[model samples]
Target chain A: MRHTIPPRSGAAFTLERGQRLTVIDPEGEQVADLLAFSRSDIDEVISSGRSLDYASRIFLTTGDALYSNRSNVMLRIVEDTVGRHDFLLTPCSADTFRILYDDAEPHRGCFGNLAHALAPYGIGPDRIPVAFNVFMNVAVDGDTGALAVRPPLSRAGDRIVFEAETDLIIGLTACSAPQSNNFAFKPIEYEISS
Target chain B: MRHTIPPRSGAAFTLERGQRLTVIDPEGEQVADLLAFSRSDIDEVISSGRSLDYASRIFLTTGDALYSNRSNVMLRIVEDTVGRHDFLLTPCSADTFRILYDDAEPHRGCFGNLAHALAPYGIGPDRIPVAFNVFMNVAVDGDTGALAVRPPLSRAGDRIVFEAETDLIIGLTACSAPQSNNFAFKPIEYEISS
Candidate 1:
């Protein structure tokens, strides 16, 4: 699938109810990670465990509820653009990048996955960690239990929107699928409302 | 803030040249912990302390290169949404939840976070383990060395993207920031692509 990135970022948004968030993946060719938190609270929702689970992309949906340690409602997807989401899935570092691309140089361009998200509070990798990956197409091999990564199901100007009851803090990786072998470039766009 | 959610059970894809990934946060949002590995080489990635610093998110993102026990590249963020992607953070769990949350509920819901995302892999908390909440906004009180919850700076639709040069596997969580009533409910939106 061929994808054309916009001139601006992948998405643009505004915080208000009944608003919309959009992504133009012209060919289901872009994947993103979505996370949320309370507006008043000054922290993230998932510790490390749940964040990794979210990457699997199993329980993300309209009715699916993501609860924090405090048991507060994180977010509800009011609308969806392109295809469904995959809460489980993440990128790799230089080592794995070399493993895949053989000739690539080794470097830790950015090592913080999900666990790194909560380090600010001294909550090291033992607590808050990995996160969900949306819009990337991958399937588990029934027999081998292997996850297959290929193209995506989104297209140009495709968008997704959610209604955040509380303030949400999101972390997105717009273009590092091949950690060391980036080459993936696109500007995602979005709209958000309270 | 606001966010956009990918479709249900859906994903996006992007193609690249060589290995050049791009990652940018919405604005000033800080992304903390991060984990990466190979989709087909899960064991190798897990056992190796390089790509995924099990004990902490600190060394994970440092300029140091990560290698699996067998010496494979798990991940290397070509770009970073937040500057502190290499910091060491911890994963949130049920035990921690019980110790943190203000109210007393069965299971405490800390494990629930991981349970929800790990259900698909059939890897329960016992099998897979806890996770790290990557990119969560937080801070520490200088005077008391106490963990503080800062309003997550991640705006709506803020994203961090990386190239999947390797089949990466990771875990995540939303931990308890001291600033809140013990159990901080910082919601988040997450996604990824290949």
Candidate 2:
């Protein structure tokens, strides 16, 4: 399966166990919030906290496994063109705009987009979990411990591949953070294959 | 609606806008993971990060609004018998077992319980988000900023109430951490009324 997720919008698909899904940042600078859930059970979804605990690393790279909250293997990173995928930050949402920025106007964020995309599956807002920030550049200052979100380090056409360990429903949203220099966040191309 | 969530187990329900939900620690000294989502959208779910940012405080109490990731108000703390609630930690999951403890046996945790409880609603593991640890005594070292999870501080019958701002789904789990002297973790009584 292959599809294009337009800027400021999102998409969802089901990937069978043992299949591989690759998300491509065709424009390089855009961040894609990649989320996943077990197809058979929604509660057996991917958890970043569990992934960090099992992998013992914050940033994900090829060969790392994404674990579910139950400690089951969900997805394994099989390939990566950009090695700096971030699991530290939560996906951008409307609260992000109201609290972090001074903007009063309603801003469409990945949270809303993901919810809209997954609605057809009978998944609502309460079911959306934290996402993997693909191609996002987040720098943690060693001395101060302050976190900074930078522009993507990935070049155009860079992609990250994950092999599913279980039947899964995947959601992807082109992040809407204008401060990340992703003002004109571009579409993302995704392909899933066995 | 009213129900009792047994120790090591959980339950889920939907609360209409303007309704109130109260969670009671009847015997006290127990921790409950309280989570919520927008009934209309799953991606615009509750966000602890956004809640802290909007409330401008670490601890939640009366008048504090629980903000969704999209910055929308999901619930407002309207009353409380115990003032301490933790929004900093992720619920204990199976990965927490693997990383934090040396025990080889599989241990039940809030993550699994929430998943099971929400299964009938078509919610799975991936939908579970970071939760509010209610009545869990987490002491933050003033100088070092290190956190220690202690036993609950509230006495019997202590409760916290929230008025729903949106149509919402709520999940609660009696925390399964044995180290916190919650080995005999008791059931929690919850009531949702308009």
Candidate 1, position A138, lDDT: 47
Q: Which ten residues in a row have the lowest lDDT in candidate 2 chain A?
A: A139-148
Q: How many pairs of residues collide in model 2? A: 16
Q: What DockQ class does candidate 2 belong to? A: incorrect
lDDT of 1 by residue, B1-194 (tens): 22322111111122232333333233323332333334553344332223342222332233434444445444444544443332213344444445445436524232454445544544444333332234554343222222334454455445454554455554333333332212334433444433
- List DockQ, one per candidate, in order: 0.04, 0.12
Q: In model 1, which regions exceed 4 Å deviation? A: A1-21, A24-27, A37-43, A47-59, A69-71, A106-128, A179-184, B1-194
Q: How high is each candidate's TM-score? A: 0.42, 0.64
lDDT of 2 at B70: 62
Query: Candidate 1, after superposition: displacement of residue B68 in Å?
Result: 10
Error of model 2, residue B78, in angstroms: 14
What candidate 2 gets wrong by more than 4 Å, as runs, is A104-107, A141-146, B1-46, B52-66, B69-89, B93-95, B98-128, B132-194
